[model samples]
Target: MVVFDRADDTLRHLARYWGTFRQMGDPKRSPAIAALEAVLYEGRAARIHVIYDGPTTVGGRLIPGAREQFSTGILARASAGTWQRLAPKADPAPKSSPLPGRVHVVQDGDTHPAQAVLMTDAEVADWLTATAAGET
Candidate 1:
């Protein structure tokens, strides 16, 4: 159970997990989600738990004496500066990358391209804004 600081990170994580699942032939098993559900259901009675600052708890014990653990990789923190840096800017449109869209979205979790990419720039911007706000 990896905890992210914002909705963007959560979306990125979902993308990465999906990419790996796809690359691995979309296994008939999903241990990660299973484990997460187990802990979530079983730990509901426990009070001692660690949490990542995000829309929900990344991983933690719902109760004491439960040995549940969640593993997460590096997740970028959400900050105004970070968002500004990652957000696509407007103006004299900067040089765009030549990489195919598939290559970019599969690279990491929260950084994956949004579904609204084909929509208007304002729509895309609004999506990012909405996601960022929801995350915090």
Candidate 2:
């Protein structure tokens, strides 16, 4: 993972807030590619956690019948298996092992209490655990 500012007082923001993830025009410089690179580099096999109401993908044009937007189409294919997975059931026990290419979308203020804005790998892991355990 790219450690932009590890210091505690630097007003840390999640990876989604990074400007590079919200850029436009160049597919080579697409935010999805950057995110996939980071995730691939981490190799944690953990689910991705997206911050709600945060910096989102900028609007882009998509040709009719195209499955994806122009800028992200290629990257989406490149990261095909790294989208998201179904939430584990909230009964019995939820799997705790790291699930590669799994993504969990959480709102900043979700109905189920969660540690919003995961800023570190540890935090993300913890949140994933809580989710697995149906604690959030």
Candidate 3:
């Protein structure tokens, strides 16, 4: 889970996970809403990320989670001053991500950093296929 430190523009780049409302699909998948709520309500660091992979201890029992490297980024922002107080003092694992403090949220699908490209349905399909093939 990556807790990016976004300031307005950067916060608009990434996507947030709104739980699905049955088969109707994502009920509140709105980046704008996330950005607005996060910065306003959660402060700037009240977000969360759920990493679903490998073996993690849930309530003391160790169980391997799902494949596909699934993760969710929360837009919940706490107080900017409290980010350090609330976040981990140090990352516990080699690949662990610290609760982010302040960083730019770059646009997704950007090639040159300055230019953005929206993926077509075919591209999305190919990406999923590649991930499933373990080629990514």
**Top candidate when judged by lDDT against the true structure:** 1
Evaluated at residue 56, the lDDT of candidate 1 is 33
Candidate 3: where is the Cα deviation over 4 Å?
1-113
In model 1, what lDDT does residue 131 have? 93
Kindly list the per-residue Cα lDDT of model 2 for residues 33-60, writing each as its tens digit. Answer: 3553454334334544321221123222
The lDDT-based order of candidates, best leading, equals 1, 3, 2
Q: Estimate each model's TM-score.
A: 0.25, 0.19, 0.21
Q: Which 10 residues in a row give candidate 1 its minimum summed lDDT?
A: 101-110
Candidate 3 structure quality by residue, lDDT tens digits, 36-64:
34443334245544322222222222112
On residues 1-136, what C-alpha lDDT tens digit does candidate 1 reach at each position?
A: 3332464365346545755666545643344544544554544455423344443323321222222232221123334443333332311222334443321221222344322124677987888898989952
What lDDT score is found at residue 119 in candidate 2? 57
C-alpha lDDT values of all predictions: 0.39, 0.32, 0.33
